[model samples]
Target: MITRDMTALRAVNGGHALLRAYDFIICGGGTAGCVVARRLAEGGKATVLLLEAGGSHHVPAIMDSTQWMWNIGTERDWDFVSEPSVGLNGRTPPMPMGRALGGGSSINGQVWARGHRNDFDSWASLTGDASSSYERVLDIYRRIENWHGRPDPRRGVGGPVDITLPESPIPLVEALIASADGQGIPSADDINTDPMEGDGGCGLPNVLVRNGVERVSMATAYLDPVAPLPNLHVLVGAEVERIGLRGSHVGSVVFRRFGQRYEVEVIREAVLSLGAINTPKVLMLSGIGDPAELASHGIPCHHALRGVGENFQDHILLGGCIWEYETPELPRNNAAEFAFFCKSDASLPTPDLMPVLEECPFASEVTARQFDLPVGPASAWTLAPGLARPKSRGRVRLRGADPALVPAIETNFLSDPDDVRALIRGVEICREIGNDLRLAGFRRREVMPGALRGGDLEMFVRNASGTYFHQSCTARMGRPDDPLAVVDPMLRVLGIEGLRVADASIMPEITSANIMAPVVVIAERAGDFIRQTHGLG
Candidate 1:
């Protein structure tokens, strides 16, 4: 509880202390939430209150970039599960969302990527707002990044998140890169640059580690640096029960902290940054969902906003092409050192497939369960090929009216057959990239999924495919005419005042890259929007 406590100095109606009102109340202390808190409270412009349902991010596993894999599915992660899907032949995968201060950014592989330029352009076109175009969003990206590489037009310095390339110790990684080069895919100097030089390039992955060692999550980069602000209050371990809306306006939020219930007042507005899953869940629990659905849960409907928990999208990858390594080696920081982006089909405007080469045998947590995997070091490595722009869509709905229970997420992965074709192309690309002269000595033999082709390969994709941990668009911002549009171009809830969404939930569509970078840009834009509307000091 970082908020100043002056309850003993004042008493309100019925012996209660003042409701701890603030000019802005930002919910969820995750990636974007922390940035909003810092920007709003900077220079004491506005009295800000940031509430997180989780605890401090002081755990060593979370602080250490290389140890992030250990935190997944632990108390640090929300450990949510997907509903059974035919896509995986009726497998329910567990989602590793960060239940700690930094949200998914903390639990995710520390890869730092801004995605392709066309991905954000697609978002702008959907919203019909030029502000969301890649050009405008790029400025915010520049502002948020503090790249470890030398200064350039594409990179920025002295920013919150310090992003750099992590060292790769394995010989398999260089062999893979050389193989891709032999196939005519050159290196990308600055992948984040607009019209990326290597839009079709394959190389080592850039990471969000500070000094190439520690994880520089939003908690460490944004909130911790601004912790001294007198007007800023960050309440940790405070679970928000529901948002209280009074006549289409965000009134307050009811929460429980340390076994005591509290009602926090919002002087001006409330921003929801609870990621894709919880943001929609909160809206539905607060009576802002479909009227019929709300009544089924014994909750009166505040607004019949049917789009609160729909249009869910996640990155699903066909599990790796594993090969035995000649010597013992292990992944240090950010499991996957090499990454690739290329077109599955040239007809598409941008690359639709990405292959992430990891030093270890990598698979989504769920995929690891269905098949036999080698455990010993130097045994095998993987080339996990992913379908970046999937046509398949899913949904996130409330398990019940209770905010404590994890919501039911129906990923419905590979429901669209187009995804299968795209992934098949990725597999072919991986095979092409793997069969290079550089890899002749290091890779002894193909292990998992070896000697499998066509039908067998397709079956492998169905059983092993799972998320890249980029869940988004449950409460997207879009054009007014779009029924699925829960928020406007500026991220304001369609029919509600004094409420906005500034996280992955508001993304009309998920970007091609890990969502951490895009979410930061969105939150930075949101901070500007709030100040413009309410005149923050």
Candidate 2:
């Protein structure tokens, strides 16, 4: 039986239609989309419509924090595969994104890192929004998170997203921490609350997990609210086709479900949260992208937005040595072995540590380079060094006029020599952190990937490098003079009005850490942007 909340969303025609003209039409009811939808609907400030490409998240596996990734390649995933990469010796990469109501947050490892303040400030500098200041962003961050495990004045106590440290830790983790201390890297009691830069020690990493489960995703925190708001509607299994534009302003979006296509006109504005890969595709389908590329695909250019699919950036990673544990039993649940944050050139204050039990891989080498790292053999304890600021540019182009066809994504990973050098540094740091004598009691010899010894180090890097899977910036935001920019500082797709992209796609540069938190922050700010524009705030 459909709950009252869902029944109120159903249209008279058996669809979800809450208002004659929705104040906001949010496409892709994923991470950022849900937050925006929930906030807008909470106070009945506006009628919000949220459309999702995939269906419900009621399955037991989806809620299981440890086995959530098993949902990959299943029915609920977009299952996007990247174009062949020149960097990975011509192998293609598989990028599994969440298609359910919560988007990737529903199936991610649930690790939560707010990243560095400089990352947000850099975006503000480019966008020219002084309000994008670090302090302001921190305010938004604190407002959204409900830290449960410990008392942190820096952490918000009552928010939708539940943040906490690991419930179960491996013995190796203790050793890694000791090793960091041994190296004079002071322990940062709370990395999430501490400063992003400077000589700092490792802290107990936080995650978007609660009661050993994932939380703060779109469905859990946003869509699960009580009904009768009278302005919000959610539709699942609805795939957006294109955004219909009226001259310079977007009029509505056309989407399809169950062999029937419908168009919903937006009285005010529309937001796209289809992630970095699909946002540009949606734009090009709606006749926005590089004029030459669109024209080649028989799409008469409505706008010659040359940068619509440019400025792509992502973090390339290498796996660490899978040393056997004295306990000798593989962890039954999803617990990070540890995490590490390192520099691009292996020269930094110190590496922030993370423990990971899973890794992202592809069937071929071609797809892995989209993030600018060569598909090489390397391993770490999930130590990832993101290409915080990348110089290389890539594109997302329509395969055809068929909106059903996913746009072909090409990320020229390692196009810049600097990205590769940083990843190499990451590999070295992982080895050092992994083999620290402080954790020696748990260290068994190298297992699956083999030892990282003299002649084998290069081979490990060449064979082991993989994607951190945080792809972004295909529709980058920057100053108007920035040649490769797709959106203005306000995140409005340039040359287009009444339309905005709020997912990771609009990031000027990928953050140095996981992106779930930053994406939500973008949505929070964008919600305000929409409200202020409409005089509703």
Candidate 3:
């Protein structure tokens, strides 16, 4: 009974009419949810209901490019904190996720990085699906991007997402690229293209900003245009509790809005694009996870999918190698713009280290206190070395049956010895680039880990270590025979019919760069599968 009026559909807080059933119910109006909902509803072949736990994405802090950081810890953010990590000297770091309509795309750094070719190739190998290969994923990328830079056959034009290189990159950014080039990492015209396919390279990254001013999130690019569609209904502030299943098939979605509980039937499918954490939490709550874990929460297991919350992965970034600027320069574009991808060791097959240049000093609280770093953004710059291919794995578990409580998150960052070794090498590479002769004019002094080596340097990496906000791989896709596989190659949840996951949680492995682009690819592919399955044009 939801109306199709554009203004009325902006955000239905409460007191909105509810239809008995919809052709599709997409939970969590995040990046993937926005894309899937648009695709399913635009064909006019079906009715779709998109539910978002948070409010709208029209806030100034989310729209303005420079004010992106301001959204963290605000009402728009799901300020999740990880348990104390033994690797970081028992520190519990904050893991902020966007709760607004656009999800992380609204509050993220806006770096548009289509992961390396190997990242997708590995997915193909794991799921035994050629469509998941790099060649196929590249085609999808081409079809989705509205590239603003020099025309290239590898990139798409006239697509929904506006992608562009920094129009006027600050001098230091150029110097950082030069410094990286001097250290054997060649600079490329566009890192998302041919550069990422090879071993690795440095370049000015593409951003999801329009006219170098406003952020073009997935919600803006995909959802907003189709908001007026009569078949599509969007509900904001609707937090889903669980998926109601009739035996093996998902029948309905139960959610809470304004402290009122409601259940809406799903005529065809129920897609969960609720991110890495919430996706598995919802599944487990619906009696679809490990049997013992569900029993502990006093919930009976309807389906025993042991991989519901396992294989959790995230890119680890050390908050940085800081250098006081000789002269303060105003930040341009996304504050953290320039980036380089490279191998920590020569023997490694692909690039494992991704160091991004932050236009301001970026550090963890522990590292900042340990180093006594400057707080002013204009005073210094940071080269945050991120572990692109971390071997360590973690898991998410339910605290209790209550849907209101946050799930227990175990990031387990830097738990693997190899991860520590790789990060140490990454820090060395960052230090070498920060002090290179090409950056002499910009560097006043090296702030932290100046000459530390051996155990001291390792300690620095641990203290500075934090998440890149690319949480994924918990409810991963794999072959049916694979015991830990939660979803199949087509993103359908194992042992559950009419239920699919189209988000970062479906990644078989963490990609070798910012995961936003890879996530969009997942969502697009999901849309294709769902469309073909139901005969939607």
lDDT leader: 3
* lDDT winner, 2 or 3: 3
Q: Would you give me the overall lDDT of model 1?
A: 0.79
TM-scores for all predictions: 0.93, 0.88, 0.97
TM-score of structure candidate 2? 0.88
Candidates in order: C-alpha RMSD to true structure: 3.7, 5.3, 2.7
Model 3 misplaced regions, further than 4 Å: 1-16
State the C-alpha lDDT per candidate. 0.79, 0.68, 0.90
Judged by lDDT relative to the true structure, which candidate is superior, 1 or 2? 1
lDDT of 3 by residue, 174-277 (tens): 88888899999999989987768998999999999876778999999999898877788889988998999999999999888777777888999999999999
Ranking by TM-score: 3, 1, 2
Best by TM-score: 3
Clashing pairs in 1: none
Error of 2 at 179 (Å): 1.9
- Clashes in model 3: which pairs? none
Q: Candidate 3, 448: how far from true, in Å?
A: 1.3
223-342 per-residue lDDT for model 1 (tens digits): 888876677777777777778898989988877776666777788999999989989888888888778878988888988888888999988766677777766577666767788888
Candidate 1 Cα deviation (angstroms), residue 407: 1.1
